[model samples]
Target: MEQQKLEKLLSKMTLDEKIGQLMQFAGHFYATNNNKDPVTGPDDLQVSSKSINYSGSVLGSAGAERNKEIQERYLAQSRMKIPLLFMADVINGFRTIFPIPLGLGASWDPMLVERAQTISAKEASSAGIHVTFAPMVDLVRDPRWGRVMESPGEDSFLNQEFAKASVRGFQGENLQADGERVAACVKHFVGYGAVEGGRDYNKVDLSERELRENYLPAFQAALEAGCELVMTAFNTIDSIPASGNQKLMREILRKEFDFDGVLISDYGAVEELIPHGVAADQKEAARKAMYAGVDIEMMSLCYENSLKELIGEGKVSVDLLDEAVLRILNLKNKLGLFENPYRGASIQKQNKYLFCPEHKEVAQEAAEKSCVLLKNNDVLPLRGGKIALIGPYADNPDILGEWSIFGKKEEAVTLKAGIAKHTSDYTYALGCPMYDRQETALTEAVNVARESTHIILALGEGSDRSGEGRSRSSITLPENQLELLRELKQIGKPITVVLFNGRPLDLMEVAELADGILEAWHPGSVGGTAIANLLFGKANPSGKLTMSFPRTTGQIPVYYNAYNTGRPLPEGSTERFYSRYIDTPNEPLYPFGFGLSYADFQYESLQLSANELKPGGSIDVQVLVKNQSDYSGEEIVQLYIRDLVGEVVRPVKELKAFQKVFIPANESKLVSFSITEEMLRYHHANLEFKSDPGEFKVLVGSSSTDLLSQSFYLK
Candidate 1:
């Protein structure tokens, strides 16, 4: 397990064995140790038996006895006894499902987010997982990108904090010290979130400045927090595929960032280089990936088939292949896999940790904090009324979002179950089909609505509608579900729309009809309980939106903190020549960091330590947040900075710092933030990350749209 031992093991590996270590395949490649023969083999890929035994890692594996069986089967067949590494897409949670990462971003409490991930690590490790592809820190400007749910949100600074938190939570203080921890792998290396037209695996074209200024920082933060691995994106960066882009994978990631950790290609990406027109054949693709510094090829045979030939010939060196093989072995050694191949993997651990009551409590609390209350009109906190819970998700329990591969959907609590906990004076109806109009279902729902004093319309995209390869051109509620709202609005009862979705939706129609709208974004296993608690007065909603909700699909990439154009449209402008939209407003329906709590928070008497700030000096900005309503709640006090003049054009406003404060009913809390010159620094035209001495404005507010402003000068 030590370095000397790892090197000795690496030195003994044959050419075929060393190449096998760099090739990754799905979980089906490994046969179980059970008495029955192996059901799936490497036949389709035409991989040999020796390579199957020596292959370094496995993907999409269900942990517990199944993993132990595979490890036992593999070790028995291995020549050097090198254990197989088990990695999974354990993203947010493994079995005890938490909110999607977007929902975690809405919480804005990284420590709380960290707690949830810690629970995820505990659960996942018990299932025999060694690594997780998580904390996807890509900056998303386009909500139409389905995988946007996997990212934290649009801001780089906030996502950086989440990135660090994810690394800390998953890797912990020492990954090898305890079997409970799994190494964190921050993925889609660079600019995968900004795909053309918000489509998955499409072209990712960005200027060097745009790439450095926005997308690269979060990955830097993740690595700085000691993320153990980097996964390449499927898309191309600078017209070169990220899996085979030498400048990005080799120079920037290796030399500049100095990430000595393992670099693995995304699923089947190394083979796709041929289709990308970057390579002529699989052999050429393997050569390019090795030259580009890819350590491992996931779900592909390009490396398995071509690497041996390339190394034998003069085209590629054995040294390049050795460096990658050693890295993979080093990871296995660090994970204690060399010491114990079935580390933390047992039926006993699974029974004790998976879906435990304590873990489920954290999942419930997280779901409660993650559900954002986007709009309210004094119709919330449903103070005792005959409630009509109508829609597709009423009794259905598939509220767990995508990437919840290990969670049992049947174990999830239904919305009806949560409502029963509050009161039985509620009628439940499946109002309409999820994607189509059902007139009979609609009439039943309307009739129930007529008898109820309040109508709760739970509607949004299906769980399958917004994960990997699930991009949507239209980002809004279907007319079938919207029809339920239209028919119920005629009854004119106080309507509260509960949305179950992954991405920020175009709520132009629902915003007009619903009196209250709560974004319960695929609120995981305890989603129903979380929603019901907020519906009644049991809990207060405190989640804020991290991504902007577009007014229409046309504003696909709409977000706060965008740079203004040369010819900017003035507020409330009717001018045609200025940069503005013809049919919709430039602003989103709901801006970032926007949420409402049952308790009203008022910002007053913003004060600054000094009117001028100098280099290496700090200024303390303070504001008093008072809760006016009787309900005690948590409020996110946001601090945004605007550079009035810069060497280059800056954003209208940039979020520098924020604090989540809890105020008792009718009490006040003084929220303070210290701003230093380093926080004001930006990447110049030449990519110099330093601050410029200029006038600046400090805006303190609850959300991006509503703010109280003050000014200062950096001298």
Candidate 2:
């Protein structure tokens, strides 16, 4: 009965009012000096539809005072007085920033990631923003792609966990009742991570099985977490643009998965479909997108200009328009905007929440957790050594990384500043500039390394090198950065390389040359302090790699959970038929879920309660972990599986579960994982998600590539 009442109310809406709900535009406004493409419009200027004379949804511009004013203006002019929905690309922070998504994923603590999102929602909502285009759950492996920093790493299970965490954190209990929560938008919808050659906005091609097996899980998890909105991808899937793919948006997302929330297009994605060769023009693009399932056209005027005309010309059905409007209205009603749209537009709260001290403290903690220690030698923790800090990123503040929407860079502590805080026994030098190969600079770096008792070479692709619209064909230390490192190595100094990249890179040289290497992939806000904490032994580095670090660019699609080939490689054979690379080892520079710490940790044994189980049975798998060194640290105990034989051949190794255990020095801890029939499932050729009764070998250890195996069976 309530559903019918809501439907009746939606049905009575005028065409103009219904159309108004479909438009969204950028909201950011600043001085001409700071704004990107600022708009200069008259008092009553109408950019598109007469109904949306006052924008339907505001993006970057509306905040607090502006939000209340805009809502008032829209309400007064409209017949139904519908309130405007405000959105922003509040990816990491509204005012208080957290570490980038990739960094948070490295922590492998979903609860921490959840809290970060919860904090983000709190800050964003306090400032009048209702939706955040966040929890970008793309399963990205290539570190060359700049946006990889914004993803939850390369593993499917880890990504799925983080996806659920972010959704729960952002949405809380209910969109209507939770005033602190904001709607979460699972973004870049379908396979934005598979951009060709790791370049942003490139094409993606993968079999349906591969897509479902790997890439699709994160998005599906977000949907399952009740994410209220899904933003379409900029990339094409099977040559069809996602913004206009009925098979993806309608068939898969809406009908199959039952995502009842609004399907919003990425910025200018609807219009870009024409250039993508999927649509003829803006009108056709808008028509196809509307029919496909996109409820809101974000930052693209295609809907405002073409949808009404398309409906009149029979290019689109009124039913489709009505359906889209209903979805939008439902979201608005769910947000409680219909009850009182100006709920979040509080100037006092906005002012108080923006850059609050507590928010900064949480941001600092997030940055600390995201720092992954890729390699650590006994020489670290500085204790009290004469250290030389060298590199462009060492003193740089902009290295807070991409999507740092509101992070105050000027206030960000640099590596030099952070190290200075720890100890006064430090000198500074600018090694070869990032992405530069000047011989004089290289010589200067060598001189500095030779002079200091210990050297910390801060290096990486600059902040601009990775993120959206940024993709690299070759993800290596640019220019002579590696050459400079090699030169520094010749100086016979114990060197610690601190990386500040946005994506994964081929760090083979650093792996071999540097005594200690840290993969600090652009930790945001308190990033410097976090790295400093690890360097000075204030915090034990426990974060692991979310993505695999390839040894070479040729290994583009490398990941740990890959399918086994019929002609599997023998341990000591050099046979050509085997699935092996002739020139390079198939192994990566570092495997996914791989990390190192100052303290040594050992995995003792894997013990399972039972070796056999029934269809609906479950068992507890336990592993004994001991911290052998004198220092305390954390270890991520990863669990993988091999089905040996299946109806369909499976990956030689598939990551099943993992736990991050923190143990004090000389302490032994037992890590237990519960396995069930559901955990044994695999997607069949027909895409039914279920398990086949079979013998399974569970491998538990430090990283995906390294482990100890134990056998189990399900009958």
Candidate 3:
């Protein structure tokens, strides 16, 4: 189907049919005849079955047999026989679960992230999914928000790079390619990550400059990578909800960014405009969202009930309605759905692709790469010692994080099972429940620890504690788990802590109690196997933290790239008058790009090709990295820069580029990075993006806080 055919089909649609194309609902509404209870409708509104038959798309529907039935029923009723599109929230993986997005970000490998998405696309498309509301490119700095599990991390550059990789992974070279590919939808359009108090669906208030500087780059990166759709955020931007903000949707996204993709609202966001004090009724809500460039209403009744009335009263133009309908038709044509209504959906294909052996292999490799070693002593690599694995998460299979809607927990391997394959001289005990301390459980754990040579304490939040409407005010480990650690410390054995979580946690107490710590954040189905491999030296830990772990929860919004304040405190100063905390240090317990490997790495001898850079000229910065220990390993060499003087105040340090290299035992390798003028550009006070002529500092190191520095000038 071509553009001319799509336009011809659009011209033949009636007003009611066109309105139906813009409405989306769950598949259950049409799968069954009993509408006694409203299926996913707003509390005050009840959608008729007639509207379900005429709706253009369905959400949360899968399986080839089920989708084929619904499509046959819908096409028989639709006057134009337009096929219904299917969408779902395939965030990380569809059937074969991979590590959560946060864990994948810690790997610092965009190519691996892209490969995960490619597998995700293949599995989902075979199950009859056409679009996935995934690659959530929101930049999050707060760990209390449950949705942080879905984001990449705090840095703008890292999130921007992962955003492009996610788009290429999902959509591939073209959506109509032969492999399993679905259209990618970049979500939460503007500033949903900076909600006040780190609460979910809370109000977001920020300056225009702050919004452009930090939150908007990832979405821009997604659009530049050719994402086909955008989803509006649930929170308000500058006092106007994203679904009703004309300046944000029209000026910044449509005209400035030139994003001509279909814009859809977050779940039931259009109807909530009345409660937001921006609209008087459903009629007003539909009108405002349309004028703000929202092409489709998701799981809401405002558009179905009020759009026709608004058009009849001359309040809404027919041209605007046609424009929205045309975009939907054009996407359908692009997907080649007009020719093949089923779009390659078949039971044979679903069985052949979902949870296959090849998919499981990729999941295992991703789980291995995502494990980050935060601390280590000589107690690791338990080659011959008897081990004690004590915790509720030891034998539990609920390690899959939240938002994995289709994953089965029973299929996941347990930690006890993974370790049992390596050694038979291991004992297991359930120390306590995840959130509470039980006396009998602790007594048994102590007995097991007393008889063992080393203790591996596995601890973390429950699977339901993070992701989508599960925000927490405190990010510390549970008190009972800490108490368990305290009791186990009395046995006088080396303790290695393994954490299973969804977000960054304050580990001030855990760091003091344990000799070794590994952050294994919900490493999907093959999590236990990956942890076992890392524990026994079969694979070295190569992951680095993408988000900073604060020393305390009071330092809520902390990151590596923060602007320098005028009244900054001096280094190692404890002065009360300066900008320093009275009781705690002003730094994170674990900084961004911080991780430890079994092999020791040293950075030395920084050299620059030129001391000054002019227009159209590039400079090469080189550093030598060596593995001092007798074990081969991989290192992530990070490059950061700071503009000493600029038109606008810049951050203390900003990560510009990085390279992940492998070094043999006791061998040295030279890492080089090319610096161009494009990497130094920033948005000025007038919103113009350009670099200024000034002195800049170039820093090279393994982590943000520990660096070797040099100076150069940009002319």
Q: State the C-alpha lDDT per candidate.
A: 0.90, 0.81, 0.89
In candidate 3, where is summed lDDT lowest over 10 consecutive residues?
A: 33-42
Residue-level lDDT of model 2, residues 1-715, one tens digit each, is 1557668877788776777788876553211112223343333223533434434677765467777776776676677666788888777776677777888888898998888888888878877789888889898877777789899888888889999999999999988888888999998889998887888888999788878888888999999989999999998888899998889999999988899998899888888999988888878898888888999887766887787799889888889988888887788888888787886667788777777788777777787777888876777777676887888788888766778776678877788888888888887878777766777776777776777899998988877888887778888887667777777788888999999888888888888988888888777777788789889989888888888989999987798887788787888788788899999888788888888887788988789999986767788899999899899887888998888777777888888898877899999999999888887787787878888877899999998877888999988
- The residue pairs that clash in candidate 1, if any, are none
In angstroms, the error of model 1 at 540 is: 0.5
Ranking by TM-score: 3, 1, 2
In candidate 1, residue 465 scores what lDDT? 92
TM-scores of all candidate predictions against the true structure: 0.98, 0.94, 0.98
- What lDDT does model 1 reach? 0.90
RMSD of each: 1.7, 3.2, 1.4
Instruction: Report the lDDT tens digits of candidate 3 across residue range 248-323.
Output: 9999999989988888899899988999999999999999999998988988888899999999998889998998
Candidate 1 residue-wise lDDT, 1-715, digit = tens: 7789888888998988898889877787675323343334444554555566768898878768989988888888788898988999988798999999999999999998889889899888888889998879999998888899999999999999999999999999988888999999998998999999999999998998889888999999999999999999999998999999999988999999999999999898999999999999999999999999999899788888898899878788988998999889888888888788998787898899999999999999999999999888998899897999999878788788888999989989877899899999999989998899988999999999999999988898888999899888999888888888999999989999999999999899999999999999999998999999999979999999999999999987898999989999998998899989998889999999999999999999999999999877899999999999899999999999999988889999999999998899999999999989988989898889988998999999999988999999999
Q: What ranges in model 1 sit over 4 Å off?
A: 32-46
Q: Give me the displacement of residue 465 in model 2, in angstroms.
A: 0.6
